[model samples]
Target chain A: MTCKEAFQEISKYLDGELSEELKRALHEHVGRCAHCKVVFDTTVKTIELYCDGKLFPMPENIRNRLHDLLRRKFHERAV
Target chain B: MHYTSMMALEVNRLEKGTDRLTGKSMSAQPQKATERAESELIAEAKAGNGDAFEELVNRYERRIYRLALRLVGNTQDAEDVLQETFLKAFEHLPDFREDSRFYTWIVRIAVNEGLMKLRKRKSDRSEPIEDAVDDQGQVMPREFRDWKPNPEQLLSQEEMERVLLDAAHKLPASLRTVFMLRDVEELSTGETAEALGLTPGAVKARLFRARFQLREELSKVFKSEKSLDL
Candidate 1:
């Protein structure tokens, strides 16, 4: 498969939604093509880091403030 | 004595059968009880029970805040958006049709409110779209920009994460929303499309482009970092 075609299919491949035939074709292409392999590796890594939940942490202060705000709002509405 | 003994045996049989039925009934009770409690809480909140509303908020605060933060790109803006979202949801609680998940409905409200804030800022700044358009209003083609060689070759994972976040911040708001919703939040493409009022195909196209751009940015950063270490 050409680089263009490989790029288009990479997302589906990462999603594990690729058909077996297309997956085999892409695997074969990546095995032989250095450029396609790099793209595939980078794409997969990016998705992994994104899904692993390592990106951000909600601050404790923010959580507390939100809870307090909710309490206050609730009390105001009560009155 | 024989008659009394026969009557006692009959009573024991009935007791055993009732125990079996009660055991089965008890086994099903917790699930039904939880559902009933949820429904009651929702009813009370809708009826203006402030404590019930607070309980709902407590249950979902972290998820809601994270969503707002991801969409708004900053803590302060996220907090503001969260406040506005809950206030609005509370005000409109009576109008909620109950056909959608409460979380989904609140998320929809937060997304809209956050996007509105971004749009307002975008208008005020008058920032030109990257890759200026030509006379035909089509985006001008540009050369592929890659990261420089021989920069910092190796960065810690934390540094790499920082770079990724920076690159994500550079994405246009529309693309960023789709990326965060679909990639970060792991919402299905159809759900993202429904939330954003776009067709599923359009969501796919945008997501693909978003991923492409993000990949380019991240690879550039990694390449530059690798080069610097050398």
Candidate 2:
């Protein structure tokens, strides 16, 4: 796989969209090509940092307000 | 997403005692037992059990809140989206046909509410309304440096968040929403397409662009000191 071809496949490889044969070709290309390797590795890291769920925490006040609203609405419905 | 298949997967995942999005166990009850419990909760909630509905809310609030925050890019708006989503969910619970897991159904509501929140905010600012586009051209990587291993550990949580959110926000809303749903929320491409009213091909194309753009954006911050020597 050439660098350009490897570039196009990187995201698909990460997303598990590539077929096994193409995946191997891309993996081989990335293994030999330092640039593609960096791009591939960092892209994986990028997804991980977001998925870790530490970046956004629901603040206590917001959590309280949600429950409060739900409680109030449920009460009104009951009455 | 199909609830029956997801329920089967849930059974398997429950055996491992972890939630994929949150990485925490939702229930310690046995797999089949917990599956029935969730279905029961949904049924009871639909039947007018407020506490049952609350239990369902407690199960998914953090994830839905995170999705809202990413979609709208602020706490106040995210809070609105979160409250409104559950409000709508509770109001419409009776109409939900149980074809999907409660989480999947709630996610659909949150995404719509978040998008609506974005549209309303943009309109309030007199900006042209921009909905998600179906596709984006392929973006080539301009950066080739390796990020420091475990870059999250290098920065404080606040610093990390600022970095991640800043990069994410730089993408136009079109690609940002796709990335948030597919990559961060771990929704399947088809699920994302359904949520955004786009095609799977479009989801794939936009996701391709979004990942490339995000990797480039983050490379500026997390790149190691050594050059690649290429």
TM (B chain), model 1: 0.65
lDDT of each: 0.63, 0.78
User: Residues B1-230, candidate 1, lDDT per residue (tens digit)?
Assistant: 34324323333332332221122221111354344455576799998887787777766666667677766667789888888888888889998887766766777788898888777777777532232322123221121333443222355656655666677767676776777677655566777887888888877767777776677767765543322121
Off by over 4 Å in 1: B1-41, B124-161, B224-230
True contacts kept of each: 0.24, 0.63
- lDDT (tens digit, per residue) of candidate 2 on B1-230: 44324323433442343444466754323355444487788899888889999988887888899888887778889999999999999999998887766676888899888878877787576432343453655478898878887787899998887788788877777788888877776677887887788899988998898888888999999999988987
- Clash count, one per candidate: 12, 0
- Note the residue pairs that clash in candidate 2: none
